[model samples]
Target chain A: NAGVTQTPKFRILKIGQSMTLQCAQDMNHNYMYWYRQDPGMGLKLIYYSVGAGITDKGEVPNGYNVSRSTTEDFPLRLELAAPSQTSVYFCASRLGQGARNTEAFFGQGTRLTVV
Target chain B: AQSVSQHNHHVILSEAASLELGCNYSYGGTVNLFWYVQYPGQHLQLLLKYFSGDPLVKGIKGFEAEFIKSKFSFNLRKPSVQWSDTAEYFCAQGAGSYQLTFGKGTKLSVIP
Candidate 1:
């Protein structure tokens, strides 16, 4: 089972160019999240979805948008990319039982570069 | 405002040496703690987790973490080091909310 898969292992975009990072999970997890990892920095949450049709902002949600139209897919959109947005992005998901202790499974990560 | 802090930015150790990485969180309520490891060119994977029960939780790869609630610290340690253990370690906290807050991470380089 592909726990979580992210597309475009690498990407480069202009300052104003827009792109979407695709993430999908086959585990039917009710919880999904997007995070950016910077050099010497821990992963920072950008956005997350509790379930289909439910999305919310995370610690660092600026310059980004997300939608969860289905239980299996959560895509992140960068409308106007900036150099500050360049970093490795990771997609994660977990089964949401009453106890929210489920381990989050992460994707291979998308290395984005803004020129 | 919740935050996680990792004391060490980078650590180098020789094989068979003892290991310890410090992690602390600033959350006043109940929280779930976790340790995630990322080897070179590999995706992040769970090393261990602490929900409730024993304060000392054992994880894979001979790693273990102790949760000191009073101090709001969850420190990772291993009895022996191996060259294959070279990786980045992140300490995260799960609050009442489902989202997790991760620390800057400690890069562990185990020299052979």
Candidate 2:
């Protein structure tokens, strides 16, 4: 099974443009997350969903929105792309909640460049 | 603000050398610590994690980390390094449910 699948591995958007980063997981995980990775900055959580139709903001939720329409899908939307939004986006999913989450399975990542 | 801090931004080492990467978190309550590694052109993967139980936690690939609450530290260690160990390591805390706060990653380059 494709653990976590992220679409448009690479994308370029102009300032003020909008786009969505698609994420789907076949693992049937109830927990899905969107994170952005920047050089030397590590990965910052952008948004997360514990289950379908339930989403929450994370530490770096600014400039992004997420909708969990289904348990297998949680897409991150960039409403108005800016140069500062350029970063590698990753989608991850884990099976459980609480501290017992075995581990999060990550996608290959989508490299987005906003000019 | 809650933060996870990695002391070193980068580290270089020769094969067979020992390794230790320091990490600290700002939150004081129950903490879930994790170390994730990203190899060249790859997605991040879990190296190990500590939610509770023993202070010392062993992970995949002969890697381990010790959680010292007194110091707010969860340092990753490896007895010997290999060229294949070259990767970027991130120290993160699973804060407030499943939300993760990560420190600036430490790039580790192991020379053969």
Candidate 3:
């Protein structure tokens, strides 16, 4: 089962360019999240969705947007990419709340570079 | 705002040495703690988690953590280490909120 899948394992974008990072989960989970990992800085949340048609901004939401139109897909949009936006992005899904058994499953991650 | 803290940025140990990585969180309410490991070229995976019950929770790869409520600490430990144990470790906390606050992470390097 492809628990969580993130498309375009690697990508490069020029400054001021825009692109979308696609994420999908097959587990039918209610919660999905987008996070970026920078050197020495663990993971910073970008956006999240509690369920279909519901989304919310996370800790680090600047320069990004997200939409949850279906239960399986939650995509993050980068508007006018900047050098600071160059980081490894990860998508995760959880079955429910912060219960012990509801630990999140993460995708392989997409390494994005903005020049 | 709640936040997680991992004190060790980098740790190096020879094989079979005892290991301990400190983690602390700044949330007082009902909290759920977790430890995640990321091997080289791989996605983050759950190493262990604690919701309730015993403070000393054991997880995969002979790793375990102890939750000290008074100190707001959940420290990961292993009796012995192997070269394969080298990886980056993260500590995260989920409180009354839906999202988790992750620490900066600790990189463990176990040399043979």
Candidate 4:
């Protein structure tokens, strides 16, 4: 299985531009998450979904929106790109709730540049 | 709110040197701890994890971590290091629920 797949490995956006970071998982996981990693900083949670059509904001949900349309997809939207929005984005999935029986699988990541 | 902290922002080691990276979390309830490694130009992958049972958990690439309840720490260690081990390491904590909080990653550089 491809596990978690993220589209557009790399993208550059101008100020005021918007784009969507697409994420898909083939494992049928119930939990999906979007996170961004800035230089020298830890990954910050942008948004998460427990299941299809159910999404929640995380610690760093500002400047972003997420939609979980189907069980396999959860896409993150940057309505207006800013310089601070430049970072490496990752999408992860977990098969179970919080149990150690399942660990989250991460996508390769999308490197975004906001100029 | 739950959060994770990694003391070291960067660590440099020589080949065959023993390595340790400190990770701590703030949460009153039971939790699961994990260590993930991201190699250059690669995705973040699980290095090891601790859920229940033994406090000492072994993971791939000859890595291990000990979960000390009293210290509130899950420290990753390797008896010996290899140049290939150079990568960015992240410590993440998950509480009663599946949502996880990650610390600022530690960049480990094993110099040959």
Candidate 5:
């Protein structure tokens, strides 16, 4: 299974630039998430979607926006990039069951650099 | 939201030596704990998981994690290390919500 897929393996952005990180899943999962991993800081949640048309902010949502227009796509947008926003971004998806969720499948992260 | 903490940022050990990585989690209600490993230049993969039963969970590649609910700890252990086991390990926590929180990963380097 192709699980989760993320586009633009690497990118460079100038300050104040904008870009979008695209994520797609083939497992028909109901939950999708975006996270950024900084050195020694682990992965912090930027946004997540429980299902189509339902999205919510995560731990570190600043400068990021996400939309879940379809079950397979959850794209994260950077309206205005900053140096602090440079990090490896990961997209994950999980099977949405009852009140609890299941294990997630991760994508090959996208490395972003803002200068 | 739940949060995860990993105690070690970096660890180096000789091959065949024992290994242990510490992780702690916090949540108000029931939580699902997991350990994810990322090899160099690869995506993260599930190492082990703990949900309802068996606090001691065994995983692939001879990895095991013990979940101490009373102490809010889940530590990963391996009896013997190999150079192939060198990687970055992340501890994660998932609650009733759709989100999963990860800890600052521990990078392990096993000398051959």
Candidate 6:
């Protein structure tokens, strides 16, 4: 069902360059999130959206921005790329609130390299 | 701020060996716990989760996790490990908020 899809599986960015990491879900999930995974650092939250037109910052939202214009899309934008931003970024989504045995679904992850 | 800690960074075991990965969280309020596994070159997938009911939760691939509220820990365990069980395991906790806090993750290598 293409639970969640992320574009540009791999990319190399120059310092100070800007780019957007596109994420989309077809499951009509109300919760969408962006996280960066670093070695031995697990996944750090970047930004999240509860629903359309509702977005919020996460644990590590510096140098990044996000928007939720629709229920199916939540894109993360990096204004100025830095070497510290080189990591694997994952996009995830969940059905709704409440524990209810619902688990988040993650994307294939985008490997970004800032040089 | 909420945080998660995985005691073991990396573990290696032979096939048929018992497996246990320790996970602890810092939040004291009601929380939903989860275990996620990521195979080499593959996306992360749910291994198990604990919300309520029995403290022991069983998940796919013959995995199970015990939630010890007193200790603030949700540890993953498997009776017998298989070579295919080798993967990176992540522990996460979701509180009243929609965002989840994740542990650093533990990498397990099962030798056949």
Query: Per-residue error at A100 for model 3, in Å?
Result: 8.1
List the lowest-lDDT window of 10 residues for candidate 5 chain B: B92-101
Candidate 4 per-residue lDDT over residues A8-100, each given as its tens digit: 999999999999999999998999999999889879899999989899999899999999989999999999999999999999999865343
Candidate 3 stretches with Cα past 4 Å from truth are: A97-101
Provide the TM-score for each candidate, comma-separated: 0.97, 0.93, 0.97, 0.97, 0.96, 0.97
RMSD of each: 1.0, 1.6, 1.3, 1.1, 1.2, 1.2
Total clashing pairs in model 3: 0
- Kindly report which residue stretches of model 6 are placed more than 4 angstroms away from their true locations once superposed: A98-101
Error of 2 at B76 (Å): 0.6
Report the C-alpha displacement of residue B50, candidate 2, in angstroms: 1.4
TM-score of chain B of each: 0.98, 0.98, 0.98, 0.97, 0.97, 0.98
Residue-level lDDT tens digits of model 4 in B43-95: 89999988889999999989999999999999999999999999999999987
In model 6 chain B, which range of ten residues has the least summed lDDT?
Answer: B93-102
Write out the backbone clash pairs for model 6.
none
Lowest summed lDDT across 10 adjacent residues in model 4 chain B is found at B93-102
Docking class of 4: medium
lDDT of 3 by residue, B14-70 (tens): 999999999999999888899999998788999999989999999999999999999
> lDDT (CA) for every model shown?
0.94, 0.91, 0.93, 0.92, 0.92, 0.93
Model 6 C-alpha lDDT per residue in residues A11-114, reported as the tens digit of each score: 99999999999999999989999999999889999998888999999889999999999999999999999999999999999986553346899999999999
Which candidate ranks first by lDDT, i.e. highest?
1
lDDT (Cα) of model 3? 0.93
Model 2 per-residue lDDT at A97:
70
Using DockQ, rank the candidates from best to worst: 1, 5, 4, 6, 3, 2
lDDT of 5 by residue, A32-80 (tens): 9998988888898889999999999888999999999999999999999
Every model's DockQ = 0.78, 0.62, 0.64, 0.71, 0.76, 0.71
Question: Which stretch of 10 consecutive residues in model 6 chain A shows the poorest summed lDDT?
Answer: A94-103
Clashing pairs in 3: none
| DockQ of structure 1 | 0.78
lDDT of 1 by residue, A1-115 (tens): 7789999899999999999999999998999999999999789899999999999999899999999999999999999999999999999998865759878999999999999
Candidate 2 lDDT over A1-115, as tens digits, reads 7899999899999999999999999988888989999998888888999999999998789899999989999999999999999999999998757434357889999999999
